[model samples]
Target chain A: LAKTTQPISMDSYEGQEVNITCSHNNIATNDYITWYQQFPSQGPRFIIQGYKTKVTNEVASLFIPADRKSSTLSLPRVSLSDTAVYYCLIGGATNKLIFGTGTLLAVQP
Target chain B: SQTIHQWPATLVQPVGSPLSLECTVEGTSNPNLYWYRQAAGRGLQLLFYSVGIGQISSEVPQNLSASRPQDRQFILSSKKLLLSDSGFYLCAWSLGRVEEKLFFGSGTQLSVL
Candidate 1:
């Protein structure tokens, strides 16, 4: 499993865009970048996943740089209900899925 | 669509008591099941995983044990509970492989006194 590093916490207001970056310097070729959003007292929900370049979905977008060393999760027009912990995981079929201390996003009014 | 059911939603047990938490998946078969524990203000820790019926893999050496008796039923048990076992337990399942996206249950909050 590739170790990931992210900001401990971030602050955002309603209608603002929030981008959380995760650094995985030793990412493997077969590993994929996946992001999950977890509200308090609930299971983490899948937000977006990408192998490379950019992938957009109904909820969020994932941007993977050419070097694959890092990826960013972009959430547009944040709201108070969007406050949650965001996790960035990098793994392949043969690797163990480990969830590290994720970035806590506080969406204020 | 698939759904996972886990119970009891909240449990408060004595330290020396035995423990059993059941989790079942509906609308899917031959799925990979996993048990994870999360302490307050901490990340998730994978405790056990099962690939098929009667086949289980333990990720951590602890007081808890898991069993897969049927295709869609996963059970977590302990002969004697410990205070350290108190945490939020989550059960998840994936369609085919471990690396695939997972669907998680509502989770159980366990407190051992």
Candidate 2:
């Protein structure tokens, strides 16, 4: 499993865009970057995934550079409901994905 | 179009007691099952995973054990609970081949005293 590093916490106001970056320097060639959101007392939910470059979904977008050393999870026009812990996992689909202490996104009113 | 279910949303058990928590997935076949433990302020720790029925892979030597009686049913059990076993337990299932996405059941909060 490719370990990841991310901010412990981030504060953002509603309606503003928020970007959380994760560093996985040891990412493998077949590994993919995936982001998950977890609200308090709930299971983490998938947000977006990308192998490289950019991948957008109805919920969020993932930006991965060619080097694949790091990736960013971009949430556009955030709201208070988006306040949660965001986890970035780097691994192949079959590999056991590990979760580190993720970035806690606090969306302020 | 899949739903994962976990039982006994919250559990309060005493030390040295036996524990059994069940997780089941619906709308999928031959999915991979996993049991994860999350301590407060800590990330998820993989406890066990099963690729098929009656097959389990333990991730660490711990006070907990897991079982898979069916492809979509995963169980976490402990012969004797310890105070350290108190934490949130989450059950998840992933489609084979592409494990990028996981469908997690609402976690079970276990408070062992």
Q: Which one is best on DockQ? A: 2
Expressed as tens digits, the lDDT of each residue in A1-109 for candidate 2 is 6889999999999999999999999888888788999998899999988899999999899999989999999999999999999999876745476787899999999
Per-residue lDDT, model 2, residue B75, is 95
User: Where is model 1 more than 4 Å wrong at Cα?
Assistant: none
Query: Residue B53: error of model 2 in Å?
Result: 1.4
Candidate 1, residues B1-113, lDDT tens digits: the string is: 88999999999999999999999999988988889999998888989988899988898998889999999999999999999999999998877543568778999999999
TM for every model, in the order presented, reads 0.95, 0.96
Q: Score the docking of each candidate (DockQ).
A: 0.57, 0.65
At residue A70, candidate 2 shows an lDDT of: 98
Estimate, for each residue in A1-109, the C-alpha lDDT of model 1 and write its tens digit.
6889999999999999999999999888888888989998898898988999999999899999999999999999999999999999887654367777899999999
Q: How accurate is candidate 2 locally (lDDT)?
A: 0.90
Candidate 2 per-residue C-alpha lDDT over B24-48 given as tens digits, one digit per residue, 9 for 90 to 100: 9999898888898998888898899
Kindly report which residue pairs in candidate 2 clash with one another.
Answer: none
For candidate 1, what is the TM-score? 0.95
